[model samples]
Structures are given as C-alpha cells and as structure tokens.
Target: MENAKSMEYWLQESALICEFMVFGALAAAIFVAVKFERFWSRGRGKREDYVYDNVLWRPCWRALHPAGLMAYRAIVFLFMAVVLAFDLHNGGIHIYYFYTEWTFTLVIIYFGLATLISAKGCRQLAKNDSIRNQDVRANFLKTDLEQEAHVTESPGKNLDGDSVKLQSHQEREEQKKRAGFWGYAMQIIFQTCAGAVMMTDIVFWFIIVPFLTNEHFRLNPLMGSMHSVNALFLVIDAALNSMSFPWFRGAYFVLWTALYVVFQWILHACGLTWWPYPFLELSTPWAPLWYFGLAIVCLVCYTIFTFLIKAKEKNFPKWFPYAYQRLH
Candidate 1:
C-alpha cells in the first residue's frame, strides 16, 4: 500500500514536470517566431517571402480558371459545414471538447475564408483585364492618328510613351507588393491548419481510433472522415493554390495546440473529470514521455508539410511551365 501511494506521488510530480516543460517549449517557440517575423518585416527578408499569391489559384493545367478554384473552396466549405453540423446535432455541444472538433472547425474556417478571398481576387482580375482592354483600344486609335500625321508630313510629339511606361512600372510594383490584411490572415491560417490537420489525423487513426474505441468513444463514418477529410481537402487546396509555406510558421501550429491544452486545463480545473485523449491524463508516470513525444510529432508533421510545399515548387514549374504559377 505504501508503494502504491509512492507511485501515485511520483506520477503526480512527473505530470507537473511534463506540463511545465511543454509550456516552456511552446513559449520559446513563440518568442523565436515573433523575432523572426519582425526581422523579416524589417526588409531583411525578400518581399516575395512575405508576400503570397493566395488570391490566385494556379492549377496543374492552364485550362482551369481562378473562378474554378473559388468554386471549389465554396463547395468544400459547404460540405464540411454540413458534416460538422450533423456531427454536432448527433453528438451535442460536448463534441467541441475534442481536439478533433477544434481542428475540423479550423479547416472549415480556412475554406470559408479562402472562398471569399478567391472570389474577391477573381473579381479584381476581371476588372483589371477590362481596364487593360480599354487602354489598348485607346492606344490603337492614338497610333492611327500618329500614322496619319506622318503621312501628311506633320510633326507628332508622342509624349504619352514615357507616361505610359511609368504607369506600367507603378502597376507592376503594386502587383509585387503583398496582398493586404486578409491575405496574410488566410496564409497564416493555412499554415496553422496544415500542421494541425496532420497531427489530428495521425493521432486519431493510429492512436485513438485503434486503441481507445469503446462504448464511450465509438467510431463511425462521420467521425472517421472528420479525421481524414480535413487533410485530404487541405492537400488538394495546397496543390491548386499558389502560396508559399515557410518553415518559421510552424511556431503558430505549436502555439495553437498549446492554447488548446491550456483550455483543457482550465476545464479540468473547473471540475471536468475525463481527458479527451488518454495520453493527456496526468495520473500516470508516462505522462512526461507522452507529452514530449507529441511535441516531437508536431515538429515532424510541420516539417513534412513544408517539404511537400518545397517539392511542389521545385517540380511544378519543370513539369507545367505554362500552367503552374510560381509563388517566388
């Protein structure tokens, strides 16, 4: 009996140690991320590095239009929303207590935000094309007038050329500049979701669904797809969209998970009796190992996604020079 009591004491102490370590690591990551972001913003980073073509949807083929991308986002958002609603109706508000629900909802929010951004981008593209066409027609008329003057032996001072060149230069600079506030928000959210969906799906399929499924944690089609579909949709979106994924953004993913952990702690403090994931329970001596392992998993997953983005950038231009838009 004394041994059992001693083990319990050690387990509690170990859990506290694990919790502090996790938070400390997260804090360090956030500090580094902020420092890097500030450094990059202060003109040390390439403008293209800070800028992303989130508004444009460059497909694998030229035939697919940006509108098609917007449509795709809308459809995805609607489908995910329906699935989420159905799950909530069946499972009640308590489903929000799971990390799966939080990640799934974040995916839904991304698609919705992406849809709006894409639509706005497409509209802007159309308007610019229309203005360019009008300018072409006007220039054609001016060119004819100059030709007629040349035939009549009259001098024509074409002062518009220099102004036209200056105007085009300004426009190009505007294009190269970063897309505004919403664009960055979408990009950050995209990176955050990338790491999160990966972690959620990996833990759910290989860990929870296999070992933890019981009367209280039953697996169903909707629940299973909740784990898989988020990643599938995100992967497809990444392939279609023209956005650069930077490794530094992994800090946001870590912070996101840390926030969820803090939320769970708050709930537990308020008399919640159960943990959503078994590894999260602090009653075992293995809690520190589990916590540390998950931190490593989070880093690994983010690195995997960043590698995929790099691969896409390297290969897409070689394979589809005309169709693939380069983010850099």
Candidate 2:
C-alpha cells in the first residue's frame, strides 16, 4: 500500500511537470512569432487568403482586424464560464471555494467588460486612421488651397494658415477621449486579474493539488485542467489584446491577494476550521511567515507578467496586431 501511494504521487508529479513544459513551449512560440512578426506578411505561393497572424495556430484569431479583440474576449469569457460553472457544481458554496476560483471569476468579469467596450468602439476603431487622414487633408491642404484661391494675401502680408491648423488640431484633440474612471478601473482590474491567474494556478498545481489534496479525492477532467486552463486563456488574451499594463499596477495585484487572505481569515473565524490551502491556514506558529512568503510570491508573479508586457512592447512594433505603444 505504501509503494502504491508513492507510485501514484510520482505519477501525478510527472504529469504536472509535463504539463508545465507543454504550456511553456506554447508561450515561447507565441512570444517569438509575435516578436518577429514572422507570419504577418505571407504564408506561401501567392496565396493572399493564407494564414496571417498566429499561423502556427490558425482559426484561433480571425482576419477581421479590429474585431479580433472582440473575438478574443468572447472566447475567454466562454472558457471562464465553463471553469466557473464546473467548480460551482463540484463543491457548491463551501468555505473551500479557493482563491483561484475567485480570481477566475474576476477574470470572467473583466473579459465581459472588455467585450462590451470593444463592441461599442469597433466601428470607430475600424475607421479611425482613414478618418483622421481625411480630416488632415481637409484642414491642412484643401482648406489652405481654398484660402489661397479666394482670400489672396495683401502685397506684403501672408496667410499664416494658423486657423486651419488649429481647426485640424482641435478635431484631433476631440478624438482623444480621456479614459475616465471606469476605464482606469478596468485597466487595474484586468492587470491584477492576469497576475492572480498565474500565481493562483502555479500554487495549485505544484503545491496544493498534488501533495495536499485528500487521499480519497477523485479528480475530474475539469478539475485537472483548471490550473493550465486559467493561464492558457489569459496568455491567449494577452497575445490578442491591446492593453497597457504599467508597473505600478502591481499594487492592485497585491491588494487583490490581500483581500483573498482576509476573506479566508473571516471564513476561518466563522466556524470553518479547514483551509482550502494548507500553507494559508492560520493555526500554525509560522502563520505570519507563511503569509509574508505568500505575499512575496504574489509580487514575483505580478512582476513576471509586467516583464512579459515590457517584452511585447520592446520586441515588436506599436502597430503589431495588438500591443501598447511606448510613449516617446
């Protein structure tokens, strides 16, 4: 019996390590493909209908350009729904409803918010460049031409064209809408959610599920896929969405985990003796140290994602399908 248990433990460990490698390779391939823009131009012999962006994984994203953001969000929203529903079905509403589950729910909400924004802005996004160019032409060149023909300059006087330039400038300024409160809220929420997704899942696979899950616990496919599924979906959305993730946003990530810790403590106080995660339990003498260590781990996870965004901006052009442009 002891040997059987040992062998089962090793089998689970091996499978988890394999999953880690597979997901790592997929992420690396995506990072490289997007950085080099390898598939942006062509895929072969005069076939314009060929696979463009994400050629290695075709049909994941489409060719509709601006609408791609909406598509990506939609897919993420659906996958998160499945994960959430499956989790709720598995455990109902117990105290063991873990932090990963909450974070996953947060991600679903963020994706829903993103999809709403994308749907609202799609038409304007599609037409922005052409409309701006036309406005420039009308304000600078065509208007100046008309002024030249109709209102001729005096002998030693000249038309400065300042009014036309100012009008064009004002039009451009009007297009620059400030990202008001909700926009900024969504930004922080999304970045924090991304970091939480990675951290919570990593802990689940390596620490909780393997060594800590009860001996008689029977795992379903959805339970097995939870950790990788969270990270994979977020990475896909990261690859296909244009969002600016600043370094300071890591503060929000810290706040999110703090909230989860507080919630767990509350649950413990309210007659729940068991913790969803062993390291999170406050019954030990090392509880404070465990909390501190977990906080540090969360920060590291957040920093890793911040660096991922930095890599995207540094390696690729601003105009790449979906990436933030660095300020000059």
TM-scores vs. true structure, each candidate? 0.87, 0.64
* Residue range 1-328, candidate 1, lDDT tens digits: 1122244533468767877976897898788577655334553554545754433443444567889989999999999999999999998999988988998999999999889888887787687668766766676677678878677633333335634764586457645756677777787889999999999999888888878876668887888889888999999998888777877777888888988887776776666767788787666778789888898889888888888888998998898888776545
Return the clash pairs for model 2, or none.
none
lDDT of 2: 0.59
Compared with the true structure, model 2 gives a TM-score of 0.64
Best by lDDT: 1
RMSD of 2: 14.4
lDDT of each: 0.77, 0.59
Which tens-of-lDDT digit does each residue in 1-328 have in candidate 2?
A: 1121233422454333433433444455354433432134232322212222211111222344546767877787987787688778867876145786788788888888777766656655446556655665555665556667868634212223544555566445533443444555566567788789889777777667777777434456776677677777777676655565655456566656766665764565455555677676543456556666666677688887878766766665635555333221
